[model samples]
Target: MDSLATTLLSTNLPPTDLQRDSVRQLILNYQKDVLDLRSQYRGRTSPLDVMARREHALQSIAAWKVVLSPVRRLPFEILGEIFVFCVVPSLRSRSTSADDPREPPILMSHVCALWRNVALNTPRLWSDLIFLFSKSLPKRGTVPILEDLIHPSTPHALRTYIDSGAFSVSDAPDILQQLIAIPEFASRVQTLHLKMGTRHLEDLLYDPPPVFLHLETLRLDICIGRRQEFVGRILKFLDSPTLRRLTIRCTYWEDAFCISLAPHFPWAQLVNLDLDVELKAAELVRILTQCVNLRQCGLFSLPDHKPRRYFEICTLPTLETLVIKGWEHTYWLFEIFRFPNLTLLDLVLGKWPTEALQVTPTFTLTHLALHCTYDDTEDGLALVLRFLAQSPMIESLQLNDIHGIGLIEGLTYAPSDNPVLLPRLEILWISIASWGDAAETVLRDGGEGLVQMIESRLHPDLRPSCAPAFAELWEFGFKCWKPKFSVSVQERLANLEEDGVLTWWE
Candidate 1:
C-alpha cells in the first residue's frame, strides 16, 4: 500500500476510470480488514475506541508540524526585532489604556510559553513606562501584572502625566505620594508632564524634591487660584543638569508676579524653551540674556510694557526659530534682540505694528507667518509688502485673518523697472476671515486677483526673468470664511492644480 501511494503521488493528473475503480476496491478491502479486527477484539475494544485513536494521531501530527514551522525556527534576535515593531505603535498611541488586554506587551506574553519567554527577554519591549495619574488608580490587578513584566535589570525610561484637576484638594497629596513610591521612580523618569491646581502645587513645596539624574524634558501647566510664592521651590525640584527642554504655562494671572519669583533656573543650558506666562520687558530681556544656547523659543503673550531703563541689545547667535504672540507692543522685540541665524518667525498679534516694517537686515529668514486677530485695515497690505521687501530671502509666507484683495493685487507680478517683492518665494498661504460691507464686490475682486497672482508666479510664460534666481512657487493655499469663490476662478485654479504646477488647498 505504501508503494502504491508513492506511485499515485508521482502522477500529476487525475487518475483514469480504470485506475479509480482499482483504488476504490483497494479502499474497500482495507475497510473490511479494519472491521474484522474490531470484531475480533469484541467487547475489549470497539469502533468508537478506534476512531478516538485516529483523532489522537492526527492531533499529534499537527502539534509536530507547528513545532517545525519556519517561523518557529527564527533566530532569537530576529524575533526580538519583530516584537519591537509590533509594540512600538501601541506605546506611542496616547489613547492606549494601561490595563488594555489587547496591549502588545500583555497580549504577546499570553500567547504561549515560547512567546512569553521571548517577550520577557526582549528589553526594548518593556523599556517605556507611561503612567497616567488621575482621580483613582488603574483597574485592580494592573499594578501587579506590570510589576511582574518589568524587571529591575532592564534599562527603561518613565513618562508620568499627572492631572490633578479631577481630584479634590485633600486627595492631591495622597495621589502624589503613591506616584512617588514607585520603585526607582526618579532615576528612571526621562519626561514629566504635570497639570496641577495651585493647592496641589503648594503641597509639593512641603516635601523634599527627588533628584532626577536623567530628566531631559519637563512641562508644567499650573492653574492659579491666587498668587503663590512657591515658584522658586518648584523650580528647585525640577533642577536637573541633563535637562535641555522646558515649558511653563500659567493661567488666571497675566502679571509678572509668578515669573519674577523664579529667575534663577538653569536657563543657560536649555536648548528649547516655551513660556506662556506674561513678562515685563526687563524680565523678558533678562531671561533671554541667559538663554544664549537656545535654538527654539516661543513667547505666547508679551504685555505692552517697555523696559524702564536702557539695556544692551541681546543677541542669540544659535537661535533659529522665534514665535511671538502678542499685541501692539511686540515690535520692541525686533528693536532689542538680534537673531543672526534666525530662519523662521511666527507672529500671532492683535494688530499689525508699523514699527515691525523696520526689521533688521542681518537676518537670513526663510519662513514668516503673521496672524492678525482683528479685521483687515487699509495699511495692512503696504505693511506686509515692506516687511517682505526687507527679508528678500523669505521662501514661505503665511498671512491669516486679513482681506485678500489688496494683498493679492500687490503680489501680482507686472513688468516694471523694480525688482520682485519676494524673489525667493516658494510657498504662499492666505486665509481671509470675512468681507466687510461689500461682500459681493470684495469676493469677486479677490478671486480675480488671486488667480492673477498665482499665474504670474507659476505660469512659465508669465514668470519674470529672475525666476531662476529662486525656487518656483510650488505650494499655494487659500481659505475664506465667507462665500465660496466664483465658479470661473475655481475652474482656472483647478486647471493649474491638475497640471501639477502647484498644490492648492482651500
Candidate 2:
C-alpha cells in the first residue's frame, strides 16, 4: 500500500517544460491530491515533502477549476493591413521568371492556416497572381482550382495574371472563357497581364468580357507564331478608351512592332506607353507623333541604322520623361527635333552617334541621364559638352555604364575654342560598372592635373548657387546587366551637382 503511495507521488520531470493541457493537468493534480493523503496516512513522506504536499492540497480545488483557458478571438483587421505592405513590389524593379526557374508568391498562402485565410480573404492580395503550369492536370482537374480562386464569391477586387504557354492554347480558350464568365469580377479587374509565348492568345480572347472596359492597364508579352494576326487581334481588343497604360513586348525585333494608329490611339487621352519592338528612325519618329498625351515611355533596345534618317526628325512634344534602352551614341549626331516639355530623360545607350540633339526650349531639360557604353568617355563627354554648349541650361545629370570626365586622357577639357560649362549644373553623378583602365589611365596620365585645370577654368568662386552640389550618387543596373554605380565630384568634378545620393535636388 505504502509502495503504491510512493509510486503515485513520484514525479520525474523532464528538463524541458511541457505545454499544459487543461484536461490532463486537472487529472494529474487530482491524482497528486489523492496520493498526498495516502502518503500522509502511511507516514511515508518527510517534513519537507509533507509541506510541499500541503501546498498542493490547498491549491488543488481552485487549480482544477474551469477558469484556466485560452480566450479564442480573431486577429485584428490591422493585422491584415500589415500583410498588404509586406508584398509591395519595388516600383522600379521587377525580376523576370518567365524563362528562368524562379518561385512565385502563391506559396505564401500555404505558409499557415491563419495566413492562408487572411491572404485568401484579402482579395487584393491574390490580385498579383503569377503561376506557371509546368505539369499536366487531371482530366477532371485544373478547372476546379482556378474556378474556386476566382469565383463570383471571391472578393471582387481580384486582378488577373494568366500565363499559359504555347501548348496551352486549347486549354486557354476554356480558361479565359471561364474567367470572362465571372460577371461582377470582370469589371473589378484593373490590370490584366497576359503573356503566352509561342501560343496565339488572341483566339482565346474571342469573347472578352466587359471587364476590359474597366481595365486601365494591359500587358501582352508574346513570341507569336503569327505576328500579324496576333497584333491585329490585340489591336482589335484594345477598344478600351479608358486604357491608359499599355505595354506590349513581341518576340520580333523592336521595329517589327512599330506604331500603327486606329485614329483613337492619340485621343489626347493616353498617358503612358511602353514598346519593346523592332524600330528604325522613320518608324520610331512617326510613332512618337501619335502619343500626344504620353507622359512616360520606355523604349527597349532598337536596331542601329546609319545616315541618321529616322530619329533626326522625331518629336516628343508632350513627353515629360523618356527611357530608351539602346545604342544612344549611334543616334544621329545631328540634333534633337523637339522635347518641348520634357524634364526627365533616361537614355540607355545602345549604338552611338545615331541621332543628334536638336536644341529646343533648352533650359527645360532639368533631369538628364547618359547611360552609355563608349570607353572614349572623353569623346562622348566632348560630344555632350558640345551638345550642352548648344543648350547651356541642364539642371542635373546622371551617367551610368560610362567612364567619368575624359578631361584627363591628356586631352583638353572642352577645347578652348569658346568652351561651354554648365552654368546651372547643380547635380552630377557618374556611374561605371567595369572598373578598368578608366581609373588607371587617369592616374597614370595626370588625370588629377587635368581635373584641376578644368575646375580652375569653370567659375572658381562658384558657391552652392541656390542649388545642391554633389547631391547624390550610387549604383543602378538591371537583370544580368553588369552591376554599375559610383559617385565622385570630389577631386574630379566638384562645384558640380545637387544634394542627394543617387538622387538630385531640383
Candidate 3:
C-alpha cells in the first residue's frame, strides 16, 4: 500500500498547538500498534484485531482535531490593519460585516503552530470596540455587544451616530450610557460625527464629553432644542486647539450671536467654518474680526442694517474667500475697505443701492459672483461696465440677476473704434441677463454678437489670426444651486485637468 500515512496527512488540515501533542501521539501509536496487530495476523487468520486497532486510532484523531482550530494569531501590524477593516456603522442583531463572507482572521487558529503565534501578538487585531443596542430587542432582554480591535500604539478613530428619529430615550439609552460609562472612548475618537434628534441634545449640552482635543474634522447635525445651551456647548467644545473644519446647519436659535465664544480661545485655527443662521450684523462682524486666519466662510440670512462705513484694518488678515447670502444692501458694498488680499467675492443680494456707486477695489479682484434681486438701471449698469472695463486683473465674472439692464443703454467704449472691455475675462455668464433687455447699450448685440465684436478687436494678429468660438467678454454666473463639494464638481475639475488649466495635486 502506498503509505496510507501520506494519504491521511493530505486529507486533514495541519495540526495546531491545540491538536499538536494529541494528534501527533495518536498518529505515532497507530503506526506501531496496527503494524504489530497486522504482523500477529500475518497468515491473515486474525484480520479482525488489526482492523479494530486501526479504527480506534482514526476515531481518536478525528475527535481531537475538531475542537482544536478556531482562533488564529497574526503579526502586530497586519492584525492592526485587519481589525480596522472590521469597524463600521453598527446596526442591531447582525454584525457590521455580515455581508463580507471573507473569512475573518479568526480562522488562523485552525491552521498550525506558526499561524497561531502570529495572530496572538498583533495588538491592532483587537482594537475595534463597538456596542450595538437596538429597539428590536425583547422588552426584558438586554445584551451588550462589544468588540475591541486596537493596537496599543496606533491612535484610534471612531465615528458613531444615533438615528434618534424613531428612537425614544428609553429605547436608545445604550448610546448615552455607553458613552458616559467609558470616558476613554471619547479620547479615541479623532473624527467625530453625531446626528441625533432634539431630545438628546439637552443631555449632551449639560454634561457633554470634552471630545475636541486632537480632533481634526467635526460634523454635528442636531435638531433644535434649548438653542442657547446648545450653542454654548459648541463654543465650549471648540476650545480644541487642533480643530480644522467646523460645519453647523439649521440654526436652532433666534439669533446667531446670542451665544458668545471666546475670541482668544485657540479655536481660531479652523480652516473652514459654515454657519446657517440669522445673525445680527455685529455678531457676524465679530466672527470676521476674530477668525482672521479663516480661509472659507459661508453666511446666510444676514442681518438687515444700514451700510455703515466701518473700515477697521484687520490685524491678522489672511482671508481669501467670503460668501454672503441674503444680503440686505442697507449695508454699504464698498464698506468692505480692508480686503487687500481677497481673490473671490460671492454676494447674494436681497436689496440694492439706491444709486449706481462708483467703486475702486484695492485688491486685484479675480472673480466676482453676484446673486441679484434688483437690476442695475442704465446708469447703474454703466457704473458696473466702467469698473469691469478698467480692472486689469479680473479674469472671470458671474452675474445672476432677476431684472435686466436696459436696451441700447449704458454705453462707454474704451477707444471708440476698437472699444472692447474686460480683455482678461475668459469665461462669461449671463444666467439672468436677457439679450432683449440690453441691446446696444452693454455690448452692441446680445452676448453672442458682443463676443464676436470683442474677438475682432483683439489686436489683429495677437495669436496669428486665430479666432476663438467667442471672446472672453462676459463670463457670467448661473444659479445652479447644489450641495457644496458635491460629486458634480469632480467631473468639472476632471475636464479642467484634461485642458491642462490646473494641476491635480495642487
Candidate 4:
C-alpha cells in the first residue's frame, strides 16, 4: 500500500483505468480505517482522550506553520523595519514599564528569541519616548528602563513628550538629573513636548534651553505658578534652526494667561503655529508679519482686549489656512489680513456680524466652519444666511452650537429670505447636542428646518431657479444628540440618504 501511494504521488501523468480503480479502493480503505479509529475514540470512557488527540494534531500543525512561516525568510534588515513601524511615536520620549504588555517594542521582543535579538539591535525601534507623570516625577528606578529602550550604538534622534507638570522643581531634581544625565538624550531630541509647571520651566530657562540642533517640532503646555515676572524670554532661550511647527498653551491656576513671544524667536523657519493662549490683536499681527513662510496659523485673541491699531493690514502671502477663535468681530479680523491664496477659514466666535461679511476680502474660500452659542432669534439666523449668500465660493460648511437646534433653524430660515444662498455649496455638516428640557424642542425645530431646507434645495418643483440653492451639494451630514425626530421627517431624510444625497447620524 505504501509503495502504491509513493508511486501515485511521484507520477505526473493520468493513471490508467486499472490504476484509477486501485487508487479509489485504497482511498475508501483509508477512509474506513479513519472512521473506525474515530468510533473507537468515541466509545472511550473519558472525553479527555478525544481532546488529547485533537490537541496533538493541532500542535503538529502549529509547529509546521512556525517552521514554514514566510516572515521567517525575510532578511533581518527588512524585519527590523517592520518592527520599527509597530512602535507608537509617543513611546520614544517617555519611560515605559518593563512589564507593560501593550508596549510594542517590549511586546515584539517577547515573541521569539530571533525577534528579541532583532528588536534589541534595531536603534530606531526604541527611539521615541513618551512620559506622562501623574503625581510625581520619574524616579531612579526608571533610568535603567529608559537606557534599555534606546539603541546605544545608533545616534538616532529622539522624539519625546515629557509631562512633569505635576511636580515642582524641588521635587523633580532627581528625575531632571536622570533625564539630562545622558548627553545623547539632550542632543538627540528632534521633537520635544513639555507640559511642566512654572518653577520647572523657569529652572529650565535659567540654563540656555538644551541645544536641540535636530529639533523640528515643539509643543509647550506650561502651567503658570504665582511668578509673573520673567527672568528671560522663553522662546528666545530655545534655539532650533530646523523647528517648523510650534504650539504653546499657557494655563495659570484656573485662568488662561497671555503668552508673549520674543522678537528674535524662530519665526523665520516656522510653518505652522497654534496658540491657545490669549494675545493682543496687534501683537498677533506683528508676530505673524515676521512669519514670512507661514502656511497655517491658529490664534485665540484676548477677550475684550481691543487691538492697538485696526487700520494696519498684515500681508501673509504664503498663508493658506487660518483659524480664529474668541474674536468679537470676525470681519474686522479678516480685514486686518490680506490672504490672496487663503482657501480654508475656521471661526469659533461669540458673534458672526453681517457687517463682517460685507467687508470680507474678495478671495474665494473653499471651506468654512462656524461654532458659536446661538439662540432662536431671527437675527442670528439672518446673519449666517447673509454671510453664506455673500461668500459665494464656499464648498463645505460646518455649524455647531451648544443647543444644536438653532443651527438647523439658522440654515433653514436663511434660504426663505435669500433663495440664492450657498449655490456652490457641496458639503454641509451639522452637529447638535441636547439642551436639557429643550432637547425635544431642538429636535422638532431643527428637524422641521432641515426638512424645509432639503425640500427647497432638492425637490424640483420647490426650487426657485435653474441654479438651486445648494444645487451642487452631494453630501449632507446631520448629527443630533437626542435623536427624537418625527417619523415623517426621519423618513424624508432616510429617502434622501437612500438616494445617496445625504447621510444622518445620531
Candidate 5:
C-alpha cells in the first residue's frame, strides 16, 4: 500500500481514467474497512476515551502547524532585534501603558510558544521601563507584567522614566514605595527621566538616590508648589561619571542654577546641556564656563540685565550647536559669549535688531533656524537678511511662525548685482502658523514673494556663482493652514516641483 502511494505521488502526469477509478475504489474500500473495524469496537471503547483521543489528535496537528510556521524559522537574535525596534519608541516616549496591546514586546510574546520563549530570553527588549505613578496606580496589580518588563536575566542597562506629574499625594506613596523596593532596579538605570510633582518631590528629594554608575542621560523636570523650601536645599545627589547629557527644567521657579551649580552635579563632564531657566547673563556665563566639553546647549527664556561692570567674555571652545529662546529684550545675551566652533544656531526671538550686528567671522555657522513671534516687525526680516549676509557660509535656513510676508521680499530686493543674501543656503523652510494674523494678512499676495525667492536661488544665473540646490530644498511648508493660493503661483510652483527644484506642502 505504501509503495503504491509513493508510486502515485512520484508520477508527475495525471493518471488514466481506469487508473483514477481504481485508486478511488481502493480509497473507498479502505474507508469501509476502517468504519467496519470501528463499529466492531465502538461499544467496547468508552465514549470519554474516544473524545480524549480525538482532542489529542487535534492538538498534535495544531502543534505541527506551529512547528512548521515560517516565522518559527527566524533565529532568536533576529527576532529579538525586531522586538527592540517595536518597543524602543514606546519606551522612549512613555506613552504606552503596561497592558497596552500596541506595545511590540508584549504583542510579540503573546503570539506563540516559540515567540514567547524568545521574547522572555531577549533581555534588551525588557530593559526599558516606563512607570507612571498616578492616583489609580494602573500598573500596581500587574507585578508579573512589570517583572517581564524588567526581566531578571536581561543584564542590559535600563532606560527608566518615573512620571509622578499627575499623581496625588495619597496615591504616589504606594507606587513610589513599590518601585523603590525593586531589587537592583535603580542601580541598573542608565537613562533616567523623572517628572515630579510637589508631593512626590518632597518624598524623593529627602531619600538617597541609587548609584547610577552607568547613567549617561538625565532629564529632570520638577514643579514644586513650595519652591522656597527646596530652593535652599540642593538635589545634586545624582552624579554619574559617564553622564554626558543633562536636561533640567523647573516650572515653579528659576532655581535650577542652585541645583546645577552644586559640586555633586558633574557639570564638567557633560557634553549636552538643555537649561530652561530665567538666569542672568552672568549666571549663565558662569555655568558655560564649567561645561568645557559641551557640544550642544539650549538657553530658554533667559532674562539678563546688562551690568555696568565689564563682564568677562566666556568662550565655549567645544560647543557646536546653541539654541537661544527669548522675547524682545533677550537678544543681548548673544553678545556675552563668542562661540568659536558653533555651527548651528536656533533662535526663537520676539524682537529682532534692525541695525547691523557684528557676528564673529571666525565661527563657521552652517544651519540657522529663526522662530519669529507676533511682536516681530517687517524690518526684522531685513535685519535677519543682513545677519545672513555676514554669515555667508550658512547652508540651511528655517523660519518658523514667520509673521511678515516681506521676509522673502527683503531677500529679493538686496542691492548686490548677484543679490544672493544667503549665498550658501541650500535649504529654506518658511512656516506661518494659522494663529499669526499679521502673517496671514500680508500673505494675501498669494505667496508671490516666496515664489520669487525660490526662483532667484534656482535661476541659472545664480546657481553656478551662489548656493545652488545641491540637494532639493523644502522651499515652503504650510503646517495646519493653507493660504489663498492663486492659480498662477500654484502653476509656477508645480513646474519647479516637477523639475526637482523645490517641494512644498499645505
Candidate 6:
C-alpha cells in the first residue's frame, strides 16, 4: 500500500486502468480487514485505549481518502469560479469587516490551504468593500488588515458602500481619506453608495475633485441640511462620464433646490434616475424634459400645487417605468406630459383623481399599481374602470387601500354580448384596509367577487365560446385588514394554489 501510494503521488498523468484497479482492490481489502477485526471484537469487551486507536485509524483513513476526490483535480480557475458564485451579490456590500467569518470571502479562506490561496488571489472575491464609520471610529489597525486581504495587483472593479451613521467628517476624517487613498481604489469603483451628510460630502469634494473612471451607479443619502450652493457643488463634483444610474435622497425637503440643481446632472446620458426631493408640477416637467435617455425614473413626492404658467407638453419617449409616491393633483401630471412608450405606472396617491383618468392618453401599459390613502369612491371606481378599459394590453394590476366591490363586480366576466376588460391580465393583487362595519361588508363581498373573477379567468370552459383566447391568470393575491373569507372559499382557493394553477397569497 505504501509503495502504491508513492507511485500514484509521483505521476502527473492520469492513472492507467491497472493502477485504478489496484487502488480499488486495495480499498476493498482494507474494508474486509476492518470487518474481520470488528467481528473478532464483537462479544469481547475491548480496552478504551484500543477502541480509541481503532476509531482514530478509521477517521484518518477517511480523511486521507478525501484527498483522492475528483474535485481535488479541478484547476484553480474553475475552483475560484465556484467560490465566486457562493458570494451573494446582494450581501456583497454588507461585509463590514475583513474578519467577518460569516461572509463568503472570509469563510472560504478558512476552509483549507488551497481554498485560502485561491480566495486571496481571486480579485472578485474581495472587490466589494463596505465601511461603517461611527462615533467611535474604526480601530487604527482595521484599514491595514483590509488592505492585506484585497489583492494588490487585481484589476477587478469594486463596489463600495460607506455609511457614516451619526458621524461627521470632524469625528473621523482620516478613515474615509485612508480608504480612498488605497492604491487604485477610487478609479476602480464601479458602484458607490454613500449615506453621509452634506458636511462629509463637502469634505470629500476637495480642490481637484475625486475622479471615478468606472463608476456606473451612485446613490447619495444626505441626512442633514446644508446651503443650496453646497448641494449644487456636490452634484457637480460627483458627475462622471461613465455614470448611468443615480439616486439622490435628501432627508430635509428641498423642492426648490432640486429644481435649480437639476440641470447640473448629465441628464441626457443617464439611463435611470431617482430623486427623493419633492417637486411641483412645473418642476417635474422641467426635469423630465432634460432626461432624454432615461428609461426608469422615480419621484418621491409630488405636491398638490398647480403649475404657475402654461408649458409645452413634455414627452418622454424612452421612459418605460415611472414611480411617484405621495402624489396629489394627478390631473396636473397627465395634462402636462405624455408617456408614449411607458409600460409601467406606479402611483401612491393622497387622493384619487377622477379627472386625470379622463385626460390620460391611451397607453400600452403592461403593469399598473395604484395605492390610495383615502377610501375608494364610486366615481373613482368608475373612472378607474374606464381607464383600464382603454388599456387592453395590461398584464398585471395592483390596487391597495381600496374597498370597491363594484370594481370587482365590473371585472367579473359577463355572459351577455359585451367586450371583455383586460383580456390579457395575468396577475391581480388587491389589498383592502377594512375598518368599520360597512368596510367589512364591502371586503366580504369583494372577496367573493375576486374568487369568481379569478375562476372565470382560470377555467377556459366557463368562458363564452365567442370570447378571445385570453391569457390565464397566473397569480392572485388578496389582502384585508380583517380576515373575512368563508371556509369553503378558503378551501377552494387553497386547492387551486396547491395544484399550482395560480399563486394565492393573503
Best model per TM-score: 6
Q: Estimate every model's Cα lDDT from 0 to 1.
A: 0.61, 0.51, 0.48, 0.59, 0.59, 0.63
Name the 10 consecutive residues with the lowest summed lDDT in model 2: 477-486
TM-score of 1: 0.68
Q: Residue by residue across 1-506, what tens digits does model 1's lDDT show?
A: 45544544333223445655655666555556556555655655456776665455455445333433457557777887898887655333544443346776667777766677778788777665544444454433224444554462167676555555453534444444545555566777777777776677676667777778788888888866446555556777778888888888877644445355367888899898888876667888888889999998888867676688998877899997777775655777777888889887777645546665565532488777777664445455545555665786775566676654444444543333343356555555566654443344445664554544543543334333222221122123234422233465356446646853223122
Sliding window of 10 residues with minimal summed lDDT for model 4: 465-474
**Candidate 5, 52-130: lDDT as tens digits:** 5545545544533333345644677887788777767745476655444566567777776667777788888777666
Model 3, poorest ten-residue lDDT window?
477-486
Q: Tens digits of per-residue lDDT for model 2 on 1-506? A: 24422322232111112223443465577777767676775676456766666667656544433223221123535545666667635322334221122232344455656556666666554454433333353222335455555542245455555565545545544555566666654666667776665344555546652445577777777665435555546655645667788777777533354433233344356687777765555655555666677887777755455335434455667777666675554454224346677776666543344134443334566677766666565666665555555445665566566554443441454455454556765555555455443444444644444444444433343333322222222333211111112243242234333322122212
**Maximum-lDDT candidate:** 6
* TM-score to true structure, per model: 0.68, 0.63, 0.55, 0.70, 0.69, 0.76
Task: Report residue 388 deviation for candidate 6 (angstroms).
Answer: 0.8
Q: Which ten residues in a row have the lowest lDDT in candidate 1?
A: 466-475
Model 5 lowest lDDT segment of ten: 464-473
Give each model's clash number.
0, 52, 29, 10, 0, 0
Order of quality (TM-score): 6, 4, 5, 1, 2, 3
RMSD of each: 11.3, 10.5, 12.2, 9.7, 10.7, 7.4
List of clashing residue pairs for candidate 1: none
Query: Candidate 1 — which residues are off by over 4 angstroms?
Result: 1-93, 96-104, 133-153, 169-183, 253-261, 326-328, 349-352, 359-362, 374-378, 405-421, 436-449, 454-506
Sort by lDDT, best first: what order? 6, 1, 4, 5, 2, 3
Error in Å for residue 355 of model 5? 6.6
